[model samples]
Target: MTTSDILRAALVGRLTENGTLTDAAWAKAATAVPRELFAGSYFVPIEGSTPTGYRTVHPADPGWLEGVYTDQTLITQLDGRTSPEDAGEQSVTGAPSSSSTLPSLVLDMWQRLGADAGHRVLEVGTGTGYSTALGAHRLGDRNITSIEYDPLVAARAASALRAAGYAPRLLTGDGLDGDPEGGPFDRLIATCSVRYLPMAWLRQVEPGGRILVTLSGWSYANALALLDVTGPGEATGRFLPGYTSFMIARPHDRPPRPVLALLPGEERASRIDPAKLDTWTGSWVAQLAAPSAERMGSGGNQILSDVATGSQARTVPDAAGGWTVVQRGPLRLWDRVETAIEAWQGAGEPQQDAFGITVSAAGQRVWLGSADGPGWDLPV
Candidate 1:
């Protein structure tokens, strides 16, 4: 067997052992597909670099093939422009715009999607086309339509898919808009996270179809949501178990912000531990409360700055007791967060699995325990 085959087998074995690659069809697809072909080149983050820096890795580099086959998300692009080829041997720093998501997460999501052999699938954010290839292999290339927001990323993915001997429908445009001509797909899966469930996806998917996506926000906390389209412009589903995150959809990402100048407005004692905002589900609750606020810092010294209204909330440990929060601007960022967190705590401090989302023409709201339970309206 070739070295590639050995690495691929090991990956499949690891995934199967961990119960992620359960279906025989998905296992076959994983075994057959060469991850390295799509990877071509990727970025390795430099350790302890301010603003985070990445160094490129090429095919000629030792352990490149092994790294490709490893179950890890590999950064492919930065700042929506720079790629490994562009950076060459230099260490560059920028927010990651594209990546090859870890194999285990990809396959696990595909399984959770509940796609069958003959189902037509719409895939968003075809970063490396690796996930698209897997889906095409399991569901047939003719049944898969993958869209990429970046033209260059799409072109590279198309080339790689061709090289891998698979030809799925590839489109260069916004994945959020989806494919108008290729409507009514049985399954719609996004590789990126959206701030709110897009109405277009609800309209495009057939009734009873499934849309599996990660719900994220300015706070950066994410949870996987699997919704079943019940009717036109409506769907309801629960947050899946376990933590899943993806790069925010480019269009849904927060707008550019000016330098923050902390201003004083109101001060109060924090109702809940400000450090709760640092936990996974707590941060998610905080996000639900202040959807437009960008969160920074951590633990006792948590900072929240609102993007739309210029509202800001900063928390620090109180010298006398627990925590104190200072707020300014129109929105009481900390008040909302504290209220939401208290509600979540009142609901017994459940994990993400206890949360579910409902979408309608009125708006979408993510609820805890049940649809009627304490819920937060998505900033739709």
Candidate 2:
């Protein structure tokens, strides 16, 4: 086997072992699509970095093939503003804006989506178009419509799709709105995460269809949701197991803010462990409780800053065994976070899979355990 052949097999093998790729058809399509063609030059995030600095890898880079073949997301753009090619050889700092999502997740979501022949699909966040190519390979190019928020990214993906001998109806627009003219689709999958379930997607997909997405927040906490469309403007589904997240859709991203100041606040004893903020599920619950706050710091020195009202919550070691939390401004960030943490603990510290969402003409709610259980309203 050639290098691409061997590396491709190795990557596929890993996903198969991990149960990320299950079907024979998806496996075949993944192997056939040249990932390098879609990711001609991608970015590798620098370890222990800010703004997600990237190391560019071109087709000429000795490790380019290996990097492309690895079953991991490759950062493609930063701050939705700069590309690896634009930064030359030096590393630069900016948030990751786009990526060729991890091969495992791309295939896993596809496997769960169950799109097949005769199925018309709508894909949001085309990115590098690798995932779209996989869908095109399975359902045929004519049956799929992929939308990208960035025209430049869409154009690059479109060119690569054609070079690889496949073409879906690639368009440039706000993917959060779905394809205004393309759906009533059998399946809708978003490669990017959203703050809430977009009603537009629910309305456009046919009843009994599936919508695979991630519910993300300003705190960067995210959970994957798979909804079965029950009727017009409605759907109900549960959060799938395991950890997976994508960048927030551009339209749902938090607005610009002034530099954060971690000054003093009203000091008092904390009711919960400060380390809970580092716990995977605890952080998720905290996000659901205070949906508008951005968390910072770590361990005993954690910080929560409200994005809208500029409220602040800072934690430190107390004279006693517990933590001391300080709060400032209108909202009580730590109090909300503490309540959520207690709720989760009271519910037996359930995993992400225990969560589910119900979307209707009224609104969407993410609940723990059941539709009537502890829940939060998702901004629709």
Measured against the true structure, the TM-scores of the candidates, in listed sequence, are 0.98, 0.96
Pull out the clashing pairs in model 2.
Answer: 51-94
Segments of candidate 1 deviating more than 4 angstroms: none
Q: Candidate 2 at 321: error in angstroms?
A: 2.0
TM-score of candidate 1 against the unseen true structure: 0.98
Best by lDDT: 1
Residues 1-380, model 2: lDDT tens digits: 88898999888888888877789999998888889888878888778876556788888989999999887788888888788789879887778888899898899899999888899999999999999999999889999999999988998899999999997999999988888787879999998999998888988999999999999988888889899999999999999988888899988888777999787889889988888888778888988988888888899989999898999999999767788899999999898889888888899988889999999999888899999898988755
- Residue-wise lDDT of candidate 1 within 61-150, one digit each (tens)? 998998998899999999999999999999999999999999999999999999997899999999999999999889899999999999
Give the whole-model CA lDDT for all candidates, comma-separated.
0.94, 0.88
Provide the global lDDT of candidate 1 against the true structure: 0.94
- Which residue runs of candidate 2 sit more than 4 Å off their true CA positions? 48-52, 263-265
